[model samples]
Target: MVDLLKPYLDLRDAEVETDFGIDDPVVYGSRAAIESIFTNLIVNSLRAFAQDYSSGRLESAEVCFRKIIIRTKKLGDRVIITFSDSGPGIREISIDDIWIVGRSTTPKGSGLGLCIVRDTVEDMGGAIRAEAHGELGGAEFTIELPLRN
Candidate 1:
């Protein structure tokens, strides 16, 4: 799945810098669920960044990948995945309302992506959170799932 979405994530010409910290990959969960989670996050990130660029807020005054980082790690008995983007952070006013059903700041209406993310994570006995990217000046999502043995 990552291979298929690699191109879409490429920002520096045709190259993408990815970091996977899972020393030993394990098959502990449904592959379809994992793929869906990543697909939604990545696609949404792309859309948000594009919107920010169109709004003329980027430092370059044009769309450019200053940086985007995807990191994964296995610690003790859990797997953690973090997706960070380098676009304008989520508007302050929409932060609390982002995950609420039918509360979308975008024109599309009925914002439910993050709500679904929360549900899926809970269903999988995992956890997820969204926060400001700090120095990255965007939003970051962290997903943690038990490393089933």
Candidate 2:
């Protein structure tokens, strides 16, 4: 997942930190499906940073400190993966609407990223949620998937 998002992260000048808490954590899903889910989430974070930068929400000095943290943990028979960023967060009123197709908070967005993410997660028998307040002060996406037997 990190490799797939390297270019975008480099382009956005964003810092990424990853922590895999468990050894060889495995989930019940295809590689492509998992990749797609993470790709969309990372892309969305990058987009949020870009938008914030363009709107002057992030100053020049703070640009270098832009952070995105990806953490994975094993919770019993489930795996929890979290993607958190330091970019602008989703509005409280819009959090529930984020997964709706054609509903975008940014002008340049197609509004389908989260929609697809939710669909793919459900297809894999997993669940996903968005949190308005993240440790990084931006949007946080938590995905829970059943561990592969």
Candidate 3:
């Protein structure tokens, strides 16, 4: 995942930290589809940081503090993965709209990113949700997938 997002992370000078709570976490799903879900989430996070930077919410000097964290844990028969960032968190009112097919907070966004993510997750029998103020102080996406036995 880091390799796939290196370009965007480098472009924004963002820091990404990954943690796996378990020795190995396995999920029952298509590899490509699962990759796509995380790809969109990370891209969206980078864009959020960019928006905050341009709007002066993130000062030029503080740009180095921009960060994203991805963590995974296994609970019983499920695997929970979370992706969070240090940017302006989502507003309560905008949370519902985020999953809509044609809604976007970014200017050049197609608005289909999260929609595709949700669809792909559901198709794989997984569930996903968003949090306004995650540990990272920005949007947090939590995905739960069944463990592959």
Candidate 4:
């Protein structure tokens, strides 16, 4: 997925860092849905960073202005995955509101991606949450799912 989206990332000088703690943690879910989740999160961060860059919020002096990190770890019975970025954080509204259908912060976004993300996670018997200011100083999404498929 990262390779497929490399052009956009390169265009905006964005970098992606992946941290997979387990060698090959297994989770059984719809392949397409899983890919969609990752894609949506990355794209949303990219869009947010684009806005920041366009508005001159990201200056030459700023460090780590557009980094997206995907980290995964395995617990006794669950797998935890976090996707974060160094762009602007979310709004004052609760993180839950960001998953509402047709709700969007971007100017040209239709707002369907996040809504689908929430639904897909719930359908897979997983739990997902968002933090406005995470380890990356921007928005973060953490998903927890059963280790055994």
List lDDT for all candidates, in order. Answer: 0.70, 0.85, 0.85, 0.83
Worst 10 residues of 2 by lDDT: 87-96
Give the residue spans of candidate 4 off by over 4 A: 60-64
Q: In model 3, which regions exceed 4 Å deviation?
A: none
All candidates' TM-scores? 0.81, 0.94, 0.93, 0.89
Q: How many residue pairs clash in each candidate?
A: 0, 0, 0, 0
Worst 10 residues of 1 by lDDT: 9-18
**TM-score rank order:** 2, 3, 4, 1
Model 4 — TM-score against the truth? Answer: 0.89
Candidate 1 lDDT: 0.70
- Span of ten consecutive residues with least summed lDDT in model 4: 56-65
List clashing residue pairs in candidate 4: none
Model 1 per-residue lDDT tens digits across residues 1-149: 76888777674322234689885456356777787787777666776776676566665544656456778898778889888877676675466677788875455646777777777777788988888554467788888888778
For candidate 3, the C-alpha RMSD (Å) to the true structure equals: 1.5
Query: What is the RMSD of candidate 4?
Result: 1.9
Question: Model 2: per-residue lDDT, tens digit, 53-87?
Answer: 88887688877767889999999899898999988
Best by TM-score: 2
The lDDT, on a scale of 0 to 1, for candidate 3 is: 0.85
Could you tell me which residue pairs clash in candidate 2?
A: none
